[model samples]
Target chain A: MKLKNEQEQKVKAGRYGKNFGGQYVPETLMTELEKVNKVFNELKDDAAFKAELHELLNNYANRPSLLYYAKNMTEDLGGAKIYLKREDLNHTGAHKINNVIGQVLLAKHLGKKRLICETGAGQHGVATATIATLMGMECEVFMGEEDTKRQRLNVYRMNLLGAKVKAVTTGSRVLKDAVNAALQDWASRSEDTFYVMGSAVGPAPFPEMVKHFQSVISKESKKQLQEQAGRLPDMVVACVGGGSNAIGSFAAYIQDPTVKLVGVEAAGKGVQTDKTAATIERGTVGIFHGMKSMFMQNEDGQINPVYSISAGLDYPGVGPEHAALAECNRAQYVGITDDEAVAAFDYIAKEEGIVAAIESCHAVAYVQKIAPTMAKDQIIICTLSGRGDKDVASIAKYKGVQIDE
Target chain B: MSNLAQIFKNQKVFIPFIVADDPDFETTVKNITALAKGGADIVELGIPFSDPVADGAVIQQADLRAFEAGVTTQTVFEIVAAARKETDVPLVFLTYLNIVFKYGYARFLKKCQQLGVSGLVIPDLPYENRDEIVPLAAKYDVDIIPLITPTSGQRIQKIAKAASGFIYVVSSVGITGERDSFFAGLSNLVAEIKEYTDVPTAIGFGIHTAQQAAEMAKIADGVIIGSAIVDIVAKEKTNAPQALEKYTQEICTALRTKVEQ
Candidate 1:
């Protein structure tokens, strides 16, 4: 069905529009995609769905997470003042649960009996499986065999939540393999299963749906920053893997062209080496994981395997909207090397008394570099997306150091 | 000598399947030489696409490995252009629609005709989508071979009628995968296809083993084994020319045994 003119324009003008959204998959799942789209559209106006989500956001998720001004750090060298959007305080330790809750709820609304998802760092998978079990729905996750081994604890956590996990063993055995496995499974069982895409990636409705769920971060951050400083932040910073946190935090502020949006990438070794996954800095435009985006690929259209100490940033492709944003120069992307990220990890733990994921440390690391050069009152917000609990061991190994804490 | 139909009617011909950019280009050229030395009458070379939904894991892996090794559409045409000097095997190039679409259909067909390519097997192109290309292909005398799967009912008659050169009857419902009974139910499928048209019917997808090839040869005019032969040719450590000669000899020996019977 064609979208109404107003509705179509509303969707198309968004960061990644209908042209970049929608299913570009095999014919097997056309009927299922249509059904899921129909059910999701129908539930868009259901007050009950909104009411349940509001209550959950308030009670369970700690809604409208505080955007705390970093006065001490801001005053230390003093360029632009820094504010921390404390998304790390959200239930389940990150903004990932926000998306999982919304999608799982949609699955319930669609009468899907089972949910399937693919994850790399396992944060999204755990969040998805947790919500599935919470709703008493069956859940299964396909993770790369390599990732399953590295993220054993997350695999254990998901298994504890009554979700079945399958180790995918194809092509590089990473996020792309997991995606292929999930698509194959979804194709075979599309009638009853809902594939919960982890990031603001994949075919339409998903990129748009995930962006909507994550948009809460920006909405809350804008209001919180306004209330605290009586003005909007001059810039917002977040790390980009699949770009969920960055997209979430920047979506509301995107229309404000003055607000500089910066996304940090894990540039392992350096951009010159094959170890980096910095799409904006080092990648070229290509299609991968069902979206046209910046990918680290060779001329033959095969995605080159990417490496980063942080598994969350070790993906070959970035979100399509991030690609568009970089194209339009609405957002500037900065690449952070492994050594710099490691240093920032230690710096944040010692200075802020907060342990952050290696992925989040990329954002912290960027702030450390640029903070000292800005004006004192120029407010910049950094999204602390997740805590460092999952990255402690890897961070220690990188520094040739061990941390007891 | 003028066309596949005329050539096959007068001679017992060999059609060897070589995946485009298989075992790397240097090795692919060497394998083409081996196929020539092994007395192949015609050669069907396949170009790999990103989403080869009709292929199974082994063939998929070969394609993935080849792509990683830098084999592309342009490289496939280059390989054909290079190999044309080595052998007179009427080169039948098998590819998906996207490659043609990307190359522009008229230009792609014209290029093949210019390159002395004999035929094409675009498996996914149905009769409805064949309108634009068929007339042009006929104009160039490039035989457009169509497939008749077991699942194809009255469509088999239509496919046979529309088809030129030889009719390909898919041995099974699935994509290219190696199996024990590669010719299982193949004889009956061939007989069923033969009733519809006088075009010689060749069986493909799984004609891998010698016994299977021999059984298939008893009834069918030609047997096409792709994924299995490509797998044998692509092993990194093996001498590809030797492997091609060994496999072709085995299949041809089997074909002769059935023919004498």
Candidate 2:
């Protein structure tokens, strides 16, 4: 079937869903971003690119994760039906492989021999290291010293993958600090090294390109939803850290005006409280990680330190495009407190036998509040961005309960 | 026409380079006006960025001093705007690309235009990056001046052709500092850039003495002195404005000597 006129114009106009995606960076880097974007656009329909990506996705990442419906949770919510995308079944155990495959290929195309990335939860860092190892490119990951201590197993896993993980001690000693260190490294060694940002943020082509890579999530979800139920979901909810998973799940659905998009941010205590990473709710516009975006910052323009029980959601800023979406009212920003997120994790696990990552639990908590009030047929898809396996210790600690196993 | 541009077109153009808010804000304003009074066609005000990797120690130290004096991007703009009201000499701001990019390219240009700035000299903005700026400059009536060095080859002509105003021909590849002799290679470089375009060229970087300015004035359209004038002002404990007038007169008189001889 032919796409509608507005749809065709929207695709051709390249609004990319508002003025959110464009080259806003240093003149030197803007040149490179434009070059990469041009190449990526031309190769979008190239059969070879698709085939190459597919080969890696299947043989390497073990693609085509099962789509399972949570019937028990659907009954408990007493509203819209929910289905899991099962990205947690990927080889690295998350959807990060999708982006890593795309970026590693892009690096090879760009003739770069080294890959650098920053990670807070260590999932993106490990995924990047995994791809770099497979591609035989030198890999380096910058993580906050505190995060290195918190996510030690993932640190070990990255080291085992032969990627050197550098502990960043500057700034707030968290994700934003790690990003600062990574950017500093990239600036000095930009000629030979490609900085693979883990999320849809940073200057320009990064936010756009990373979103494109991860859009496969929503693309697959759309088809899965069509097969399961003859229509699209009314709302799509996901957690926003640097907003990788949120961008992934929401990118394909952005043009659908009927679909309400909700981005759940980690309000450590609450939006009004001191401890939080709710950049959209609490932040002002500023530069961080080489991009101009809404960020929690002090009067001197330094990024204010943020706190969240979930390391993944402890960043001081969200993606610039996400900020734009909120501004345009195309997307709504909601904050989930740490305690409520913890309760949602227990609620989902006990009710549906689905233990969600602390970051993903924010989305789960949003669904718990929003789903009950919706009509029976009004569907809500909560993106299970990651599994809870990494957060088992945190969950145990939160409940004052210890896991012997 | 801006008084600076008017004076530039009137006769043999005279320009003096100084880092803004150097030593302190008070000295900066005094030095700028002194240079203007001493027949300076225009003053090239340098906005110091945290990382000035391209500059030499003298200019770098001047930049550091300016920054230490609590000079910020907005502060520099505010100083220029205030200076514009008092002096007819049009101010040309020199800076790196990062500051402009951070301030938003369109907004920065708009602000400069509003502040009555006649030109801009960004060392990092290459020929390719001139697409957006070239048009914006025309719209705002601000000239985007391109810098060339003694090492400029065929690309010098391309840069000169792309240039909206005069070309800033560096005396050497190195940063701004005081030097005794103006090398023959520099004159040859200026002559080479001149062969391709008719735009006036100003020779700068490492030029210190009267003989050096005289030598530069022999080959280039104008001679620019930065570090020497800045160093004198930085050294004197008092009467910086008077010292600036004395030094600028000395340099201008030296250039005039070369013109007559």
Candidate 3:
């Protein structure tokens, strides 16, 4: 049963790589997760599934979102030709809708009537609620109690979309705790419920499935960029929370080493301080939220309480695939401080008249940092993963500006 | 490993669980002794982790209390080392994979051997994901107890075939907590597991009362009462030793009555 060196090398590479992504969930959820994997494999290549999914994305969530040429910013930076992949234009105003629509279709095909998910900034919560309403399935979302307060507008949106929001109040009461609540709920009711992981950081089929669905970002941009710009961009940038958007935006270009991929993480105050969410920068190899990924934890393996001004980018771990990519240097990951992201947030909205989500602002901040040093002809595409309206109140609060409640 | 197997011989079994250092380290040591004095066949100690996705509210709160008490892996081991002085009760650490993976596997397992801790019951480390550490666990003579839920289906054979010391048969398809009723045809699945492995199967999850324990032990070799016991600890706090002793004795007396029949 032993293999040759080539096969051995392939064997050494795990589901994501040698060190990430597996089914480390409870045995109670094993059969359900396995069924999801089987169903995904069957439907991924099915022409009918693809056609249905494409139709929904086009007519419902707004597919082929405009890849805008940021002419003003390009001239302002005077370094790289800037392009913004406008995932912000999608229904629910975030790239989260792409994966939501895809997963809801899968849940429908599997004859599941209940949908459960976890959200941080509530983008995923709103997206899941929107899609579940369209599909006429029951939707329940878990959000950190603090996040529910921070993004009350998103909570109301989810509620109006017919999804019940559960405010989680354990273990730092943030995105990770929301994930904990959702997983426990799924473990209790997997027979009739489908757990839609918002990020590409969980165990096996989830990371792969979320990536497969969100890959539409890069799939459309690659073709659109070729027709519009007549050449591939030198770099593609996206923010990494649990890395769904980053992986999706990088999916098409990962194989082409010429097109560099970058994932920007929130550094909170600074990586040197105890208040950073820069997992890839200051994390050890550990397992949590079911995947073996780079996580901020102590020597005793306790998950650290991560902090960020942007609720969307505040998690202790990066996606498993991102960890593997970082390990092999296939993609570059950098951290942005709160001040930098806020500056980018205001600048992008004013300069391009495009309000970018604070999560996506992390990537914008990074692009701003390096764009000035690059050749003007060199192009870089940054994915605006969500519209910034939900973050407007928070940004105002962060800046000590008075806002009416 | 043999010590764990010895507990199932010629009689039905009772395994009581509690979060180590739930209120404090002293209570944990006293609680283990109480369980042993109350006829516990084995004791399952929960090492608190920040995220315990497979545990229900009662046990989750217990973990929070333990963390508030500043429990660490070293503190849990110190509790275990202290308890070993009072009783020879077969002890196992029920924890998440990160707890062990974060602590070097070799070092963790070696420490388990040194402490006479016989097994592990990691809810997250399912059959497919435990390949790398199985041999290392065996090298330390520590049992990596396999879990088979109602949803395990055909995976039961694959898991049970290689399982040793014991098999944890989850009575329902959910996290660890009490339920009004378990899933139907559990005895059939227990029968299926029996066809594949010789290891004793203990039905847990939802078996809270002595009545439930007696009924579940009829189908499997033993019963595991967790959240209910932790609930007692949560309610009684430092005086959990008294409550746990009475509770363990009730379950044991119920199991013994079933054996006599």
- Report lDDT (CA) for all predictions: 0.76, 0.76, 0.90
> Which candidate model has the greater DockQ, 1 or 3?
3
Q: What is the C-alpha RMSD of each candidate to the true structure, in Å?
A: 6.8, 7.1, 2.3
Ranking by TM-score: 3, 1, 2
lDDT of 1: 0.76
**Which model scores highest in DockQ?**
3
Measured as a fraction from 0 to 1, the native contacts recovered by model 3 come to: 0.86
What is the Å distance of residue B123 in model 3 from its true position? 0.2
lDDT of 2 by residue, A300-350 (tens): 343568999888899988887788788767889999999999998999889
- Give one digit per residue, the lDDT tens place, for model 1 in B1-261: 127776567534567777777658877777877877776667888887665545667777777766776788788888878888887667788876555655667878888888888788876465544674788888887888877765555556666777788877667655677776543566777787787778887777766787877766676787788877787876742487887887788777777766776
What is model 1's native contact fraction? 0.01
Backbone clashes, candidate 3: 1
Candidate 1 residues A1-405, lDDT tens each?
222332345364232523333344443444466576667677756899878877777788887787877776677646888888887787777788888888888888778899999988888888888888888889999999998877777889899989999998777777777877787677656667899988888766677778778999999888888787888888899998888998998899887868999999989989789888887798875545555567786655546788887777888778877877777677899999888988888887887777887888899899998988788778889998887777776666665787653
Recovered fraction of real interface contacts per model: 0.01, 0.01, 0.86
Chain B TM-score by candidate, in order shown: 0.93, 0.92, 0.98
DockQ of each: 0.11, 0.09, 0.85
DockQ-based ranking: 3, 1, 2
**TM-score of model 3 relative to the true fold?**
0.97
Measured on C-alpha atoms, candidate 3 has an lDDT of 0.90
- Worst-scoring 10-residue span by lDDT in model 2 chain B: B1-10
Candidate 2 chain A TM is 0.92
What's the residue-level lDDT of B29 in candidate 3? Answer: 99
